[model samples]
Target: MIDALHTHRPRIVVIGGGTGLPVILKNLKNRHVDIAAIVTVADDGGSSGILRNYINVVPPGDIRNVMVALSDLPQLELDLFQYRFKSSDQFFAGHAIGNLIIAALSEKRGGIFDAVQILSKMMKVDGHIYPAANEPLELNAEFSDGTQMSGESEITAAGKLIKRVWVETNDDSHKPEAVQQVVDAIMNADQIVLGPGSLFTSILPNLMIENVGDALKRTTADIVYICNIMTQKGETENFTEADHVRVLNQHLGMNFINTVLVNMKEVPPAYIDHKKWNEVSQPVKHDFAGLRAMGCRVISADFLELKDRGAFHNGQEVADELLNLIGRSPDEE
Candidate 1:
């Protein structure tokens, strides 16, 4: 089915981190699309955190996910990259094989971007991947009372309602190569997508990068945001659809987004219960009226695909909806 869609070779730039962006990219792989993933580097937990502390390297988990998503490699190679060493020792526990590969490449190239390029080529990836920043960035969050928490994991666990988030970087040097590649991809892209991940941590972190934000603001591509399926407890608890768009505007500024793709269907009660998700805590109901008030078009559909305890987007469904919204004929070259 996807093989036939690869004819037009549309250029797409998907921005975010964590597991979400890669899921979307996986669905888009080998289709008639040129994918360029711009990933957030603010993670400070587990293997990524350890690597960052010891070696001053960008968190490689997100980059690794992007690589695997776009890889046309054999299943064995993919599994090997995702392998994690299980050990009773705290120091050796939970480090992923892919993270080690990226760390090694960073050492070899003396830079993260070059190492990513080399890995991309080696994997026969269908698209490119860029870290939002070249240098390691520490995420800091200011609370309503002016107290600040440092580090991404700490910020998430701080328990104080976040007032604002920013990157800590004294070095003013920007990675021109990464920035240029992002801008080039954006300028040439048919579509640019954001989210389906943690709004502030995953999506906004990419936008927080100076050059990356500038490229997004200047891009002529049609923008679409895949709204999260559920409100994150610590981060976006009780946030409505309108609230999501509003926060994005607040952080990245107005009109940076054009359309929002929201899930508009029910999840099985059994699945929700099994996943232990509070029914009352589901994604803020799609507020079509409020979304329209924000001057953004809403593309609401039954995008839910229930697996285990969570509701996920059906990849083909999401891809088709995005293509339709952008006016691409399914049969068009």
Candidate 2:
């Protein structure tokens, strides 16, 4: 809402976390779109997990990446911010400078939301970066075997078929809440994007928030889901395009998505280096008929980009398609 000059441009709210969210945001930052990112805070892994444990702050890894993606800072400054301490530094090993800064800012500002907003200004971010909820969230999941697990890392490590996922705070009495800005962004957006990340851990954790889910359900914007290029081992091992959509609808208790961006380019058999891509199992299967049956307007293209023997969404191509979709509103049609 602070971005007054771009008021005339299409407003987009991109929601999710992990490496994928940043890729999409980087692609969209230069475009003439008004962008706001709602990132997940359920992470309990890596440098973020360490800092969160020690400082009692919301996980900063996803938020840091998202901020960098939208930032207009010079390459060297950004690199310095992203720099991690060496393994030899026992006290600060593996912590990104940006994560530490965010942790300190969170303490100073009294919460993660304001810390990010202030940093957005400091970093000259081209878009708004809002944590999905103000507080740190714990992701809990129920697997098909009728077993339950807590923590994002543990759930993925279990490698069990997930039945459902939800979020809560460590303090049982205090429920996590989305800030007013996040709700307003979703409600007023011209286009809303979900995923290209882990369906359960990265994306669903945000939507499971009550206010966020309500905003998604009531928003007038055309909701679009960017399905992942590959199946995540513990998340969606054999998921088809429709299966991805089905999980979203199931979680939200509504068929809210209007369109699905699917990758049409096939991955050559034995092409992906599994050792390099530890989390990926295989290319996501296509189910055009299934997607149509669920009332989705499917947009299939060669949205794939293979690099270092790994599959990913071509960010520029995906961003262009999103712009084209948002441009032709129902009223215009």
Candidate 3:
């Protein structure tokens, strides 16, 4: 809870990709805080991957979703943009109109970074949306069994315990880097939020960017990680909330995550439809002691929202708590 009503709008830089990032952004659109979402571009799956393979452009699916979440356009117009073609359509099958539009813009503008900025204005996006990198990068991960694989989808499907993950260009090249705006946004923000997404595939891909990770570590902003409600099957199987944080810190080489927002509400066992929410394995167990020992201030609350027979974060509640954290006391947790 906010100790006092805040008059000034605080700057918040949210970093991650996948479906979960949008939930928080959608709710924050109504709040008083300024938002800058830095989404991962390492995705190599679905329509985005298909488009990337053919066009040689950055995956626009994540950024496209982020655009919709922050867009202030008309519902009808946004709906039209988000419409996906039926697989039976043959020619344009399995592709969303928005993804195609973003890809076309990326080609016209010469890169995904500028393409997103141009699209942001036309979409009337409420906040800044940035791709983690300018190019279509490959996600490479080494498993606990000493096996390695590339591509986001492949890693998860491998069903192997990911030891660590990183990004690279299509060919052997220099390190992947975030645009100046992405780095600057992190450095200037009062708060930085991570996750509510896949642990390794979605969240780690963005942070693995050399410049982005450096900014996260060097930035003085209070970094808060919104812990996922459930462990993912291939990625975070039987993992606790603290285990998630532990991986992030290990990757970054420091205890930079100052706070974590964990869901206290329980999801009924019978309610989960495994077929629908296939990625979900089980409810993420809490480790308040572990988190506290790592110097992270833990805020455990009923942030769960059961939807479509699966557990998810209550975005409004999570956004409200994030707002309350701006310039507030750690002791408040």
Candidate 4:
């Protein structure tokens, strides 16, 4: 970890995947903290899963979204990169331009890490972007009924009650190890943010990596979890705020989460469109007493954003709370 005496800006390492991760990154972009995103590689659906199957590269969907969020590129160029082919187009149908580019670069560079580093420069990304591991990872889960599932999309689509979740290598010869830079970022960070993403698939899959989890446990940095706005059907159905924290602690085998930023705003009745957001079930219930019992410093606020007929985190509000935890002001920049 960087010493307190150093005159550098506060270093923050945010860990997770899904659309939620990008929301946090974009909101913190102009802030004073140095940012490093350790994205999950266990995604196995949509264009990412298709590309992974064809080329054996890490899923680039989350990384691609994160890159656009942090990239300082012109809007037109970014749009070109993000453009997805229509279903009418053969061969290229259902593929995003960025995913294909990342796949090609990964093959040439011999690893996703180096490809992302080179891509980060080309995309003019402001902060660091690190894949959780060097290669593609498969998410494995044990359900409550003693049934097991593999792959992120399958698990979520199965609609099973999750008992546990972890990550494993695709092949027998490989091992799950995050690169040194990821560990260094975790160790040297002032705060490590967990997630506002999927509990089983997005966040825990990354933590399941041996070295990344170890670095988090060993780091001097304060650990914070940006609690989800709503509970999801497959992963966290009817879970209280404390249940989320408990699951994370259980996965790590310790009470490592130091702080939790929770949204206390009540969702207006009939606001959520369940058909539009099929995965999301209901607003996440709070249990402040339960959170306090876990030795967690809880900070609850009106960090809710209701839009497009769905409930979501107000990233800037959550970012402000995160900065406050580290004694940094968001406006200092």
On TM-score, the candidate that comes out on top is: 4
- Mind sharing the TM-score for model 1? 0.90
Candidate 3: tens digits of C-alpha lDDT, residues 253-301: 9999999999998889999999999999799988999999899999989
TM-score of each: 0.90, 0.96, 0.96, 0.97
Q: How accurate locally, in lDDT, is each candidate?
A: 0.79, 0.92, 0.90, 0.92
- Over 184-224, each residue of candidate 2 has an lDDT whose tens digit, in order, gives 99999988999789999999999999999999999988899
Judge candidate 3 against the unseen true structure and give its global Cα lDDT, from 0 to 1: 0.90
lDDT of 3 at 38: 94
Model 4 Cα lDDT, one tens digit per residue, 1-333:
334513678888999999999999999897867899999999999999999999999999999999999999999999999999999999999999999999999999999999999999999999999999989999999999999989888898888889999888998476699999999999988889998899999999989999999988899889999999899978999999899999999999988999999898999869999999998988899899998899999998999999999999999998888887777766776
By lDDT, rank the candidates, best first.
Answer: 4, 2, 3, 1
Write the candidate numbers in order of decreasing TM-score.
4, 3, 2, 1
lDDT head-to-head 1 vs 4, winner: 4
Model 3 misplacement above 4 A: 1-8, 327-333
- Candidate 1 residue 232 Cα shift, in angstroms, is 0.2
RMSD of each: 3.6, 3.5, 3.0, 1.6
List candidate 2 segments past 4 Å from native: 1-7, 328-333
Kindly give the stretch of ten consecutive residues in candidate 1 with the minimal lDDT sum.
Answer: 170-179
